[model samples]
Structures are given as structure tokens and as C-alpha cells.
Target: MTTNSIALFFMTDFSIPKPNHNKALKTLAPPSLAGKGAGGLGFSPLIALAAILLNLAPTPAIATTVKIDRWSTTSDRVTLKVKVLNNNRIPILGLEEQAFRVKTKDKFGNPHTLQSPEIRVLSPEESHPQQTYVAILLDMSGSMKQKDTARVKKLDGAVNAIRGFINLVKAENLPVDISIIPFGEGCNHSYQVTTKTIEDNFKSASNSELEKQLDELAKVPVCAATNIYQPLTETVKYLRNRFPPSPSEIDAQDKPLPKLSVILLSDGFHVYRNNEPQQFENVINLLKQNSQITVHTLGYGESLAHLRNRAICFKYIPDDRLTVDDVANGCRLPGSDIQEFIVDEDRLKKIAQTTGGIHEFPEDAEAVAKSLKTFFTTLREYEIIYQQPGSDRATIHPTKIEINSPDRGINTLQSETENIRMSNFIYRALTFTQRLPLLILTVFIGLVGVLPFIQWSKKLKQQSDL
Candidate 1:
């Protein structure tokens, strides 16, 4: 994705809503002057100050929305779209120059600033464009058995879903680097398949090869233990290594990394031996920590409810669970009743809510295909970027974003987008080393100056009274 393909536009009304006025002022204020008193100062001075501060404050920066017209044979690039908004419901705009300062560092430790001309002002109806790598993590454990007689196996459903997802991405002609990690006892070596090979392979995958790889999974006996933690850790390690060291280190060796999309399928409860909640928690923590990876978990069989509940309660679980039989029946019979069960509908809903992915129960192969299609459609429409306010590196920071589109009846943001929607406005202070010195200096300054000012003010007031 080249800079020209991405466009960013801003909408500025300068009209501050009542509750937002304080926040607007706070954000607009210089870091040094953030805590100054408002007093009884009237509206005019406040407005003047606000305008000056807006002009002097850092202009709102936005990630460029690049369009991937076609995959480059020489380099891989992913396109994504990012939208900017303020505390008010207004979409932020009018500061194109300021948006250019937004920088993304590649894996190689070099920073690249977003190009200004590439950002086009988006109208309310418009969407910003962007892209990234798509990392697929598949679960090939033995527990992916089918409950129904007519339905295909759970592993088959997963593989079919993956194939469809890959095809859709390729059809877009986007430069996507496809990596397949099949995890059973452990993760398989990543198949860094190129767009051409992926397309050709899908096309020429003989019915036998397709059936063997896409629909038939190695049915290890139920006794085989599922080691989900290993794969999760391995995948993350692979991604951290795969991403360019930094954004500016673009060389032949530095082909752009695809935004990561992880699809994890399993059926049994997470392996717990000894006081291993810590192990499970660690896996969850790793998933939560990576902002770049979107994890979708598909839980088949009786344990679907448990897996769905866990994934839904945590942001690390991106997609909802779909029973293997339901998906297979959906594929085989379209809208027919496949007698598939939803163990915990509310919990599954919550999982879908917490993770940015959807909860779908496919009744047949076509329905499975449809679910995959829907997921890919949402993926295409997503506004992906790697920008966290007040930080330069891609470290994990909790965020909440709410979208109130009354006209479209879109009142909520879900999945990865929902992370930007919390009400608590606390920012986790940087690590101790990064904050201690500044904290000490602040205390010293307040003691030396603010104490003296307070004393002097008190003395002056006493004299005036006398």
C-alpha cells in the first residue's frame, strides 16, 4: 500500500458541547498548563483561550487509509482504514497537516511519518482506508469431533473456513502474505504462502487434496491432550519476528507485514493441571497484550460453551464459537435445522461482544461459507491502524471507542473497535523508571513555587482585611 492510496480528511466545527468543553480544553492545553484554574472567568476568554490552544496544541493526527489495488510482486503491503473522532460525537477533521506527524515504527526500529497528501478528508458517509498483515492460526486438536451424524468434522469446518477466508482476501487483489499455523500437539511450521501460490493452490487443490487438507483432520484419539498455550505463545513469537523491525527500514528484506488475524479452533476445556490458572491467565495476558493480532476462537462440541464464555469475557478471544456440526450442516443444507446446540447463548454473545469477531452458528457448508464471507466482509470494512495516544511504540494500552451513528442505527462498536469504548478515563502511568524522575521533579516544583505563592496570597488577604 503506497502513501497515495491512503486518504485522510478532518471535520472541525469549533462548536464545543457542554460536557465536552472541559475535556476539549484539557486536551488542547499545553502539557505544562493542563492543571491551571478556570476560576469565574467568562465565556469569551475561555473561547479565546480554547482557540489559541487548539492552534498551538498538537493538531489531531490520523493514520493514512491506503487502498491496496493489487498485490505487489516485489513487496507485500496491506491496506487499512482509520477514523478519528473527538469527545463529542463529531468526526475529527480540518488538520491535515497535523495528521502527517503520525508515525509508525517498523520492526527494524525506524520510524516513518504518514504522508499528508495521501490523507483525504472523509465525509460522514465515507470511510478511511488502510491495511495490514493477516496471520491465520488454526487449531488442529483431536477434540474437534462432530456431534451430528450428517455433519462433517469440526476440523473440516475450520479448514474450509480458512480456505474461504484466504480466497476472499486474494480476490480483493490485496498484497497479503498468508501464514498458516496448524496447532494440534504443537504448531506447524508457518506456510508463508504468497498471493499467487495461495490463489493457484486453492484453484488447483484437487478435490482429494482439498478434501484431505480442508475437510479431513487427523482424528487423534480423545486421550491426546490439547496444549493451546504453546501455540499461542509460538504464534506471538512468530509475529513479533515477522513484523519489520521498524517502519522506516523498508528494504527487500523488509516487506511490509500483514495485519495479523488469528483464527483459533478448539473443543476441550483449556488444559489445567496443578495450580495452572496462572498458565491459562498467562496465555490470556499474551493475547491481550498484542494490539496487532485479532484472535477468533471457534469452539466445537460440548465444551463450546466454556470456550465461548472464556473468549467472550476476554478481548483476546476475537470471534464467537460455531459448533462443527452446525457449520457443516449449514454448508450441506443451507438453512435446514441441523439440530445444533448453543450451550451458552448469553456467554457466547458476550464473547462476541468482548472480542471484535462475530458469533455464528452455520447450519450447512453454504452457511459456513456465508459466515466466512461475512467475517471477511467485516474485515474489509474495518479501519485498522497502529496508533495509541501519548505513546510511540506499539505497546498494549487499554482503550474504548464508542460510535453513535443514529442514522445508520449503529450505536455500538464491537470486536477490536470496542476496545476503544471504556468509561473510566484513567491512563496507566508508564513504567516506574519512565515516570519516577518526572514525578520527583513535579513534586519539587510544586513545593518550591506553589507553597510560596499560597503563603504570599494568604498574607496579602490578611493585610487587606486589617
Candidate 2:
């Protein structure tokens, strides 16, 4: 409309109201906030509305209050335990998938975004205070009879340190299932996981059968030398059977099974059994198969570099000889085949790394106990189950899982998980077809070698008949 038409329209439609009681009340109202801009009573109506809108606007940021506890991945799913708190440092629960945005980064430092990922929030009772199972494999081999430079007997140190740890577990009142097996007492299948100290709760941990076994182990040293293979493999098998990945109880399906931590402590190298090295490898594989299991190894009393010259297997350890296979399988380090004692700190470091656990070399028995306490506290309480939509294209082992609140009211969270196995049928088939030529060539070579031998045998038989 033209300015003249606009003035005529407003004059006709919104003509000035006649003086009345309502206008008198408006005249007497507080002048500071009353609308007054277009004319004497004209309004800047947007000022209060603008303030209200700003107050209701979404907050853009908050201090980081998220910490990851522990995380693991299935072939297809990534599970994580984390602590998420609001600005008030209060745990924020009962949130839906829309409340979080998820993404992942592979071990190679490449990024992948996930879309509409499903999130399952477990109940606090089901996860946050879940029970934890720990196995303390104390070496009671003959070498325990030796003492450290501090005059602390290896056996006494192990037993006493264990005694202290058990006390700490009780003091903390942590819900745990523990096993204290003293192996290396006998050779072959003679030694076993005979001492099991388990409790549903922490109150009964003290003076349990585990303590009784500890008391007995402190006084005596085993007749045989160190045999890490038998004890470690047996422990893993026991844990796997006891706390299976798939639970049978109906209530357990909603949550995950408790994690198992195997603490393998030894002062000397592996010996006694000739196949200890191979058996140790099998133990590592077993732990790897179950992502929930972590093996924390402590090389007590000595460092890995120092143990080379003092080959415990060759010198003080009994039977003191390697089998033909043991000699062939070779030593732990780059040295004479006879120089190793099977399980050294060098090998122990690798086991911890492969299982996603930490390896610590403690100088004495006190340090050993100190390390044990540290591992127990790191157990996970809550788990987040989500499928990474980009897992199909993921090439790395342990992709990083990153979590953020859409409103930025929580800190960014990160956890790592391995990619789902290569499940594409075409990929598996292609890999097989890729190796087919080599397999066929080997078979052809074998046939060529067998035919000449068969011909020679037939000719000899014919000559004898003549």
C-alpha cells in the first residue's frame, strides 16, 4: 500500500480509543516497562518476549564430566562402561538414544560416523555395582624359597602381600569372586586349581579357604621349578566355564557377566615342563578369545633385562634340561636356545599388551601388592551397547567409540573396540579363491613326487617275480 493508503487504513481500523477506565489504568501503570515507543503509549512489545526466548534457548556447552570405565566389543556390538554427570556433577540417567550422538575412530586414527545407532541403558542395579571376579595366581614354585636383595623371601613376600590385598578387598567391601591358587607344586597334571577362595560378597573374604591355602603356601616351596603354562591355562579354562559369556539365568541376559581378572605373579622364569612355552601361547589365545578376561602379570623381584644371564631353568631349576621340542621352539630372547626359563618379563609384557591389560615390573613383594590394588579399582560398572553402523568398512582393530550429548551438557566420551569380524560372504569367498592356486600347486607337486616312487616299487616287484 502507498503511505497515504496505509495511514488511511490504520486510522480507520485502529482509530484512537475514547478515554475510559481501562485506558486510565494503563496511564497509571509503571512507566518504565509499559510499552512506550511508537507514540506516548506505543509499544516495543518484543523486549520481554526476547528475554523469555533467550532464557529458554538450549545451552551450548558444559564442563566435561564424562569418564569411561571399561569397554569391550563383540563381533558386531561395541559395549562400554562410562560415568556421565551433568553440570551439577549428578549422574544423568534414564536418557534415550536421542540424548546422545555417537561416532567412532579406528586404531589407525581414521574417523567414522554412526547414524541412528541403538542405545540400551542398563539399570544401575544391574551394572554399576556388579560383582567382579579375580584370580590371584601365586607362584609357589621352588624358586620362591629365594629372597630378594632386601632379604624378603620370595615366598613370604608373595604370601604376605596377598594377605594385605585380601584385607584391602574386605575394607573396600567390593563385591568380588576370587581364587588364590598356588601352583608349580608338582609336574604334569599333578598340579591343579585346588585352592579356590570365592565369596558372593566381600565381608566373608577374610579367613576363607583361600587364606588357609595362603598360610600353607607361605611355609613351603614346591619341589618342581616354575611352570606358568599349567596354572595359567587351567585358570582361564576355569573362569570361562564358570562365568560364561552367555549366561543361563534369565535375569542375566539384560546385563553382562562379571569380568575376570587373572593376576599371574612369578619371581623366576617358566620351567619344569618342556612344553611350557607352547602352553603359555595357548593361554594367551584363550584370554584373547574372551574379551572380558584381562591378565595382569607381575614379574616380581627382578627385571627382564637382568634375568637373561641368570637362566633360572638351566641353573637352579630342577630337571634343568630342555626337551628336543623345547630346544627347537627356542628361548624367550635373542640368545642361546638354552638360555630362557620359558616365561620371562619380556614375554609377560607381550601377554598383557595382547589381552589389553597392563604389565608392571615391581621391585619387591610390597610393590606387587600395590599393583594388585590398582587393577581391581579399574573394573567396569556400567556398559553401553551400540552397533557402529560403519563397522562394515572398518579396517582397524579397536576402533575408538566417541560419545557426546546433543545439547553439549556433558563431556565428550571415548572408548576403543575392535571391528566386527569380516563377515561378508563375498570377502571370505574371495580370500579363499585368492589362495586356491597355491593349494593346487602344492597338491600337484605332491602327486608328481608320489608317482615316481610308485613306478620304482612296481619295477622292483616285477624283477623279484622274474
Candidate 3:
């Protein structure tokens, strides 16, 4: 045997099967005598140690996977949960919470600035929340029946988005129960797909059943007018009815309130019940009052402002009196048809803002699917601790947050200013609470001063009578 082959045979454990066994053996003696016969096999203990060192060396730019799970805020402070998949081999070692930029989009699609979110990674790291409750409110108004392209309709895109969520739930095996409520003219509660839950240990049969229910929602007929308020209002009531108003219900249940999320898809405004368009604002405010709920609204086609403007034009002028040239040139719309297909943007914004939810406007049918995926990313678990913005808690506050990771491509998440229930101590900051102690001291001082005055008056009156 050659000197090199002899050295290699000794260095490696030849008894262990490896790719080069035959070639090494062919150049040497048979296995039975090779260890004993190959002239001292030139093996050193250092050689084995060197091989292990090479394997342990670090690679270039250690890859990182950061996912934004869930984010929430008090009226002032923002907290973010960022799931860092590779915590052991983090690319940006010692990354701080201040390294991210967080912002929220307005009804105009403009992202307003906010403070950087404080980041926290949950212990015993997880990719998904243990459980979730989703209410998918789909709009089945007459406008949804309109064709997007020659072949695709708006409802087709909505179904695709629903299918995307179903596939996501199955792939992740998330324990989520979904309720689908289709609304137009009024909500068809009978036609609604009630809650379907996926157990902790996932079952294929359960998944198939959920998929079948989604298919049913896809087949609901399109109806005239839009009752945008009913589905949202009813779904909230349904959720409340499921659980009684007891603290123990939240504290004792395994998944208790399991993160309520409402995904509302609408093409236009509330015109079906014409007298109460303003009622939507009240319903949205009610959603905001419930701390457990977060509403994500997706607007399809034109902006709500554009739709409302067209409706206003039609309300003032009758269609029969308008000229065809005026309609073609954009001078005036056929007032008769304007309110039938309008979207109230300001009311939608109010709902989202009060509930710490997101509002998205996707211009085309295809964009709807993409936006749904983005919304799904928000349904994760992580926590952040940061200084609360010192603002008046009694009134709604204007909050702005921003998070950025320097020297990395990690995108900043949206932050919001909404109602965050304060503790008894922190609650003292709101309204008359701060001035309470001072007011009490003032009253005590006044009582002491008035008592001395009364005693002096009584002594003087006694001397005069004597």
C-alpha cells in the first residue's frame, strides 16, 4: 500500500461505511489484516480533531427569518411580537427593539409615522398561535357579480382569498374556528357558516369539513343593495353571546377568547337600508369598545371617498334631467344610481382605528389575494414592552409608531393608537383622578379656617349679651 492510503485508512474509521470505502480498500490489503498489516498506518489523534473544527466553523452572513406575528397598542404605547426563527444563529446578534420602524396606513393609503415598536420573542418559540377565532364577513352585493376582466369576476377573487386562508390554516394546523357571514340587503344569518374548529392535534377529516363549508359560501347568490353594517354588528353580537360576561370565562377556558379577528370584505357602501348610513359609525364604535376584537377591512375596486362623492352627485340631481354628455365627461353622475354602490371610507376608518385593526384598499381583483396573505401575517404571538406615550387617556389619542432594522431587509409592521385598558394606578392619570388628592387637602384646610372664625363669632356674641 502507498504511504498516503496507509495514512488515510488509519485516520478514518474504515469499519464505518463511507463513500470511498472500495477505492481505499483496493489500494490496500484486505480488512481482516489491513489494520494490523498496513505499515503503522501514520494515524494521529490531531487529525480527527482538525476535521471536527472545520465542520464547526461559521458560514457567511448567517441567514435570519423574522416574522411579524401580532402587534397591539395602548392609546399611546405600541408592542410588537416578532418571531425570530433562527435565534441560535441570529444574523444580527444583540439586535435591540429600537432597530425597527413601525407605521400605519390611513384611509388615503398614506402610511403615517409612529414610534419604534419594542420587540419580544416568546419563550418556547412557536410559529402559530395555539388557537384563533376568525369571522370572515364576505359582501355579496349586486356589484360583486360584475366581471373584472372578460373571464374573471370580483366574487372569483373573493373565493380565492377564502381558499388561501383555508390552505394556510391546514398547512399550519392552526386551531381556528371560522364563521362566514354573507351580507347584502340584510345579513342572511341562516346562510352563514358557523364556527368550525380545528383541534390541537390536527385531523384531515376536520380540514376537509372546513373546506366544504368554504365552498358553500362561494355559491351564495348576489343580491341588490349593500347592508355593510349588519354583518359586522351581528358577528360581534354572536361572539359575545357565545361567552357570558364573566372574568372566569376568560381566565379558566383553555383558549379563552382565543384572539378574535374579523375579516370584512366589501365592494361598496351601505345603501340597502338608506335611512341609517350613520348607524355604521355607531356599530364600529361598539366594535372598538370590545378590547378583544380586531377588525381588518379590505375595500375592493374604487376608494370609498370616490364612491361617496358619486353618490352625493346623484342625490342632488335626478338622472332623467342629466344629459348623456355630462355622464360621459365626468361632469355629473346619474344621481339615481349613485347611492346604490357607495363605500363610506370615513366610517370604515373609524372602525379600524377604534379596534386597533387594519384597513386595506386593493384596486383590482388579483390584489385581493395578496392583501389577505399580508393580513394573515399579523395573526402570530409575541409581546413587546415599551414606555407608554404620555397622553390624555380619556380622549382618543393620535399615535404614530415606526420600527426599522438597520443593515437588514426586515420590513416594519403597522402600529395603531386605540383603547388600551389601564391599571388602577395608571388609570389615575385620566380626568379628575390626578387632581383628587389636591382637592381633598383644599377642603380640609377650608374646614379648619371656617371653624376658628365661627368660634370667634360665638365668643363676641356672648360678651355683648353679658
* lDDT (10s digit) by residue, model 2, range 296-384: 78777664323433432222211344232333243233353332222366667777776656677776777777676545444433456
What C-alpha lDDT, on a 0 to 100 scale, does residue 210 get in candidate 2? Answer: 65
Number of backbone collisions per candidate: 55, 2, 17
Cand. 3 Cα-lDDT? 0.53
TM-score of each: 0.41, 0.50, 0.49
lDDT score of model 1?
0.43
Q: Which 10-residue span in candidate 1 carries the lowest summed lDDT?
A: 68-77
Quantify all predictions' global Cα lDDT against the true fold.
Answer: 0.43, 0.57, 0.53
Cα shift from native, residue 326, model 3 (Å):
16
Q: For residues 1-466, what per-residue lDDT tens digits would candidate 1 score against the true structure?
A: 2211222233345675434212321224455555555553333567766776666653432322222211111111222344332321122333232232233433443544444343222331233323444445454444454532237666566667778776766666554555555555433422332333333333221234543555434433322345555665666656655553333223255343445555554444334345555775676666566545655554444434333332222122223535433332332222432223333333333333343445554444445555565455444332333333333223322332233333322343321311121112334447899889999999999899989899999999999999
Ranking the candidates on lDDT from highest down gives 2, 3, 1
lDDT of 3 by residue, 1-466 (tens): 2111101112334374333322321234556655542244444456557776665564323214444334444444444455432322121223344654434433333545443343333331243354667777888787776654334677778888877876776676667767656666633423333332212212332357556665775676665556667668777766666543433223334333456778888877665444564686679667766756778888766553333333323232233444222222232334344433344555566676676566777756677886786566556544444434443343323333344443433355334443332222333234687689889999999999999999999999999999
Candidate 3 Cα misplacement greater than 4 A, ranges: 1-128, 149-151, 186-206, 243-250, 253-256, 272-278, 304-341, 383-466
